[model samples]
Target: MSLRDTFRRDQVFAPLRPGTRPVRPGQLDTGGKHILYMEDITVSFDGFKALNDLTLYIKPGELRCIIGPNGAGKSTLMDVITGKTRPDTGSCFFGQTMDLTRMTETEIATAGIGRKFQKPTVFPEHTALENLELAMAGPKGTWQALLQPVTGQQYDWMAQTLETVGLLAQKDQLAGALSHGQKQWLEIAMVLMQKPRLLLVDEPIAGMTRQEVERTAELLQSLAGEHSVMVVEHDMEFIRSIANTVTVLHQGSVLAEGKMQDVQNDPKVIEVYLGETG
Candidate 1:
């Protein structure tokens, strides 16, 4: 029988293990509105507070942006969420049940949260398609994937992801040969292959051209409602371009939470973040 004749979207795309399924966000029950829940979380370094009593909640499939000045704890917040750093105190949960503080970084990733940092990391010698295939291999071991034949479904899925990230034309090109913006998109496509439910992106547009930034905004906005996305950025225009809701952080705590317009108009934001009144 042909593979398509027997393919199942709701079933595991590969036989990696029992209960493994193609990453389809919202397919699994989150059991609550928030995909991430944090309360009174704090972190300190040598008598300095990185995150101070920060309480935050994100609903399933919401695209939220976080902005703050230096030491406002933007990156630190992501570190805590991704389990890279432990908080000094407070509770953090993934989907209302998984205690994030209790899980290792690998475990947190397995639980369906993926993080992308400012720098794009890809195999320089590898083709764009090759980089994505490595991501699909997951814990199965790259050598094992190399030994096993690629399934038709996996090819289709990789192709779809490449198209989604607008890298189809460069599919066979060396990842290193691509432009900076293309590298960033390629990195994001790799993240998608893992089928993460919550995506944490940091400073995604720092070095992109105007066109690249707009395309990225479109891509990130499109991701909302399919996967919950949280972005940490300093570019107010980019934040205004895509974020439906923005959270302003100051001194490791939330200073304001509202639409981009409202936050942009706030006097505190003018004095501290934008550097001028609008």
Candidate 2:
């Protein structure tokens, strides 16, 4: 089946103003247009099709959620987008320029794509603010990271980020001491400091308390119009809270894509994934 048989590109990208600046070349030239592009992407592991002729698109400043069961190619799709795994066929692009299929993982990150995994990772011994400092020190020489004091401007920048993630009150607290939700926010704050154009987040509220899940939704909502965020999650309730659009995957292909309620009601989705869940 053709990709458009399920969803439309025009619908995927709703317009919003961009929020950050590009720090490096090959950055997305969204111009309030498409931030991500993919078509006919396929990946195989020993004759097992992890992803099969996948085609997807995301718009600038959009918050999109992907819901699918295991083996639906969700993780592999992220791996392909991040340059961790290359597609055996098809193509991927970021913005109007920069072919994503050709760039290295490091180049993908340098070009303003940020990824947050399922588990929150923070510097346990470091304070919330210090943890951000270390995050900002990405790939720098060890000595340089250690010798450099956070400048007043850098601290100011981080302070703003702290407030953004609802960590302003916990800035001086040890990261390890923070609650699970707070740790997730701290990790999110760390990524924002890099001014990424696109953020790929996995199951952000998986282990969060109800309150934290609510707050995380607010945080993600606040990030739109500056950063395009794509969330991969299985929590339907959480997706309902934050998803502007929901895409459902089955057998490495999109089964449905649209509003949360609409996708949830799709018979195909219900049979394959949601039926067993609820």
Candidate 3:
């Protein structure tokens, strides 16, 4: 096995060591064009190919959804894009400049990519406002991060973010006190405050109420012009509501890509998701 393959196996099977020292948010500007482009990304785990020559792209201000059956390598693909996992051989680029395959996760995030896992990971003990405050904190372990007070601009950004997420009135409320939907919104808001250029959201409406799902759809739609969003979701209804374009993954490669309606009707996508779920 090659060294890169060994590293991939370690990352998949070994205990993940915690990351150290936070990095700056990457520039949120997508240069008003193609924000992310990937070509021939491949990752193998213990001799199993998780990603197979996958090529994907996102234009600025686009909201794209990815859906796939289990073991389709959906999560692994996200890991590669976000720099959490390195591809055995491929090229990943952000904007027109930085090469993502060469950057660390911290550097990639600093360059303005933000990811949200399925669960809301807010600072439960902190009030809504305080959580945003901490999200805006500079690189951790730095002198300025410890010595610096929240700047007026940061405060302004926090307040605007709270308002944007419809939590301005609940700024002082404990995060744990919020409902499931509210907590989800708060987490998204936290990332928004960083003003990332690309946001990757995973399973956002997994447990949300119908009303909450509707609102969340609207929220993501509103962010379209200012941020490029890539959503991974299992909820077909949610995808139908929000996706402008949809990409289906199966066995670690693009099974289909097009409008949601077109992809939904695809024989390959239907055969995979329908055969299993049916």
Candidate 4:
């Protein structure tokens, strides 16, 4: 048989490994409280502390915002959570059972944590639907995935996910042809295909138009009760629009954390970040 024919047969006949499946929220052991915990986490580089004895907790289904000036270790914090960087000291946990520090990046993602960076990384040449298909939770290689047909159930779920992100109407549109904001939403939809329990978004509104910003805000708000949404943003106004609780980072530690109004009014926050922004 030819290589293409072999792959086509394998698509239907190959047995999937149990371990390759993405972990569902129902499978997580969070003890009905915090979905994530970072205790006394610290990371250092060349005598510089990127993160210094920081502790944070994220409750299940909560929308939390993180704010800070440049070099405040915001990226490093996400890095640690995503398993890109291993902290020199401290513990990071997903739910009550999973130790984040002990997991690999791929392992963490498969375990239900998804991250969307500032730049949209969709497949520009593919339609939005195709992008999600490629991102579906499975162990297939890209080529194998393209050759495999999506099951009816998977297609229905993908459509629902597109609707959730407000991109169902644009499912057939090429990712490269979509607006910047649409592309961002498309990337989010792609992540949703993995059914993550915790979503870490970085600078979601960086280049969005005002209307796109509003829509994005609404989408994020709608997602909170179902998935724990953690946003890291520099736009204070945007933060105020969606944040119920905001955490401020300075010098690689949590400088302040509370309601948006209170955090904004904090003298320490003003002295370090808000004053500079103003």
Instruction: Name the runs in model 1 displaced over 4 angstroms.
Output: 1-29, 276-278
Better of 1 and 3 by TM-score: 1
Kindly report which residue pairs in candidate 3 clash with one another: 24-110, 25-110, 26-110, 26-111, 26-112
List, residue by residue over 36-56, the lDDT tens digit for candidate 1. Answer: 777788999999999999988
Minimum summed lDDT over a 10-residue window in model 1 is located at: 3-12
For candidate 4, the per-residue lDDT at 36 reads: 82
- Per-residue error at 72 for model 2, in Å? 0.7
lDDT of 4 by residue, 108-141 (tens): 9998999999999999998999999999997888
Winning model by lDDT: 4
* Structural similarity to truth (TM-score) of each candidate: 0.88, 0.89, 0.85, 0.90
Q: How many backbone clashes can be found in candidate 4?
A: 0
* Candidate order, TM-score descending: 4, 2, 1, 3
Candidate 1 is scored at a TM of: 0.88
Candidate 3: where is the Cα deviation over 4 Å?
A: 1-33, 141-148, 274-278
- Candidate with better TM-score, 3 vs 4: 4
Clashes of each: 0, 1, 5, 0
